[model samples]
Target chain A: MLHIVNKSPLERPSLDACLRIAGPGTVLLIEDAVYAAARGSAAAPRLAEAMQRLKVCVLLPDAEARAIADRLIDGVTTVDYAGFVDLVAGHPNCQSWL
Target chain B: MTEGIAKKFMFVNRSAPYGTVYALESLEVVLISAAFDQDVSLVFVDDGVWQLKKGQQTKGIETKNFSPTYRALEGYDVEKLYVERESLEARGLDEGDLLVDVTVLSSGELGRLMDEQDVVLSF
Candidate 1:
């Protein structure tokens, strides 16, 4: 199940909701939601845990105006806009969380 | 008029007014669509309700108060503004406290409205 998160860090919900269900999926971060990739955010620990436990492939646009690339913790892969479109085109089960 | 005659494009605003770019971006899309004379409606849910709150002080944030822009929306013939009742109650706000007149709808009603929309975008 692919998860597209477009919400800011403070407004995000518990990662446990997505983590509890184990599956090989991708996570795309866009808009203010890119903050989820930022270091030291409350969402980081759980996201990291999910990546380690589940094969969660996290993707955030590198050229997106938001300067969150340098802030993302390790394990989260950064991609470009084309990569994002390709990722979505490849995945079928997408759940957008805003 | 026939019920549900128009292909409603519902813009769901979910962010606060300042400290984020989503609010302004969403408004621009709405105005552009209005220029094309498309059928559009707006719904403010979650922290998006703050955009309609009265007495906003953007000086400390060094941002302009775009609240007045919402008031001008009526002149553009885009007047279907719906605010979530639960969100308003949660934030301790009511229609009287908003910058513009809005019909407050429950979450369920809001969901139904969403289902009726041919296109939905969240900001």
Candidate 2:
């Protein structure tokens, strides 16, 4: 399963849901969703823990126009748009929580 | 309308066009998807219906009124525009006030459409 998140990183419902359901899958961040992996974001620490436990692969663009992408915890891989699409196509179940 | 082709994509617009970047960004994505020959459908609910209102004046806000862009969508082959009937009534707007032709659907019908899509993108 691949979950695509495009909402602000601080949002709780989507992140909580993702952690509960995502097991050994992938997480692709696009648009504002990339904020979760930023270095100092409040959401990063919790996500990092979930990422480790689930063995989830995280992908986010290096930059966005309005906000700088930072705070990528260990083990989360950054990827580009093509890689994002590939991850989506590869998954049997894809959910976009925007 | 090619029969049996699974090219349908649904876009759910949830915010007003000018208040934030979401609306404009969604429009660009829609155009891109349509360019790929996908069957595109849009659902405007909540404050998103404000994007379709006629006679929008954005001069005081120092930004261009993007209300006109809805009309240009037809040129790009994105013609399946839907508006929640309840949203229009709540906003005191009717089909006459929208600049584009739209199919007004009840909430139940909208849910059915969402289930029928091959792809669902919400913004």
The TM-scores, one per candidate, come to 0.58, 0.56
Shift of residue B102 alpha carbon in model 1, Å = 0.4
Itemize residue pairs with steric clashes in candidate 2: A37-A71, A38-A70, A38-A71, A39-A70, A39-A71
**Which tens-of-lDDT digit does each residue in B15-113 have in candidate 2?**
777878898888889888877888899988757788888888989999877778889999998999999887788789999999999999876577556
Which ranges in model 2 have alpha carbons more than 4 Å from their true place?
A: A1-98, B1-6
**lDDT tens digits, residues A19-97, model 1?**
4322556767667766766789887787787786444444555324676666678887776678777776776435454
Report the lDDT of model 1 for residue A93. 39
For candidate 1, what is the TM-score?
Answer: 0.58
lDDT of 1: 0.72
Best-fitting candidate, measured by DockQ? 2
Fnat, model by model in order, equals 0.03, 0.09
Docking class of 2: incorrect
Name the runs in model 1 displaced over 4 angstroms: A1-97, B1-6
Worst 10 residues of 1 chain B by lDDT: B1-10
